[model samples]
Target: MSRFTTACIVGGLAAASAFASTPAQAGYYILRWDNTGICQVWSEAFTFKPIRWPSGYKIVSRPVPTFNEAVNLQVRLRRQGRCTL
Candidate 1:
């Protein structure tokens, strides 16, 4: 097979894998500024299964609009299965 064909095949397989795991392995994350009075900022990163490819992954930084919102978002993200590692 040609190199293009091989790459296409690999990509297709990876896409399938990501799609299959997305429902079970997808997640999000959030960050909130704490009492340190903006002096301290919270940040986190997580990866979720891609929507259409298995080896595919999504890495995102947690974002929070307000301090209270941050806490709530964090909880939601955790429950959603956000990847910590």
Candidate 2:
């Protein structure tokens, strides 16, 4: 097969595996997009699945135990002028 075909297969597998994985933990995190300085509180089962494409967001805080905590963290980050949008 050509290189493009192989790459497509790998990306497809990564996306599928990312969806199929079981939950390892339940928590919230504050993610900031490096390109846009955008911050948001995300809630998802914690897993280390590989992404199928390039990513711009990174977690800025440890797994927060609750939604309230995550929101508080996001507020602080914004107040500090570190994250926005």
Best by lDDT: 2
Candidate 2's residue-wise lDDT over 1-85, tens digit each?
9999999999999999998896555789888877778788887764463342455777888988889999999999999998975
| Candidate 2 segments exceeding 4 Å error | 1-25, 46-55
Each candidate's lDDT (Cα)? 0.47, 0.82
lDDT of 2 at 62: 92
Residue pairs with backbone overlap in model 1 = 14-54, 15-53, 17-54, 18-53, 18-54
lDDT of candidate 2? Answer: 0.82
Write one digit per residue (lDDT tens) for candidate 1, span 1-85.
9999999999999999989877442233332222221112243333432233222333334545455665565555556655331
**In candidate 2, which residue pairs clash?**
none
TM-score of each predicted structure versus truth: 0.28, 0.57
Candidate 1 error regions (>4 Å): 24-85
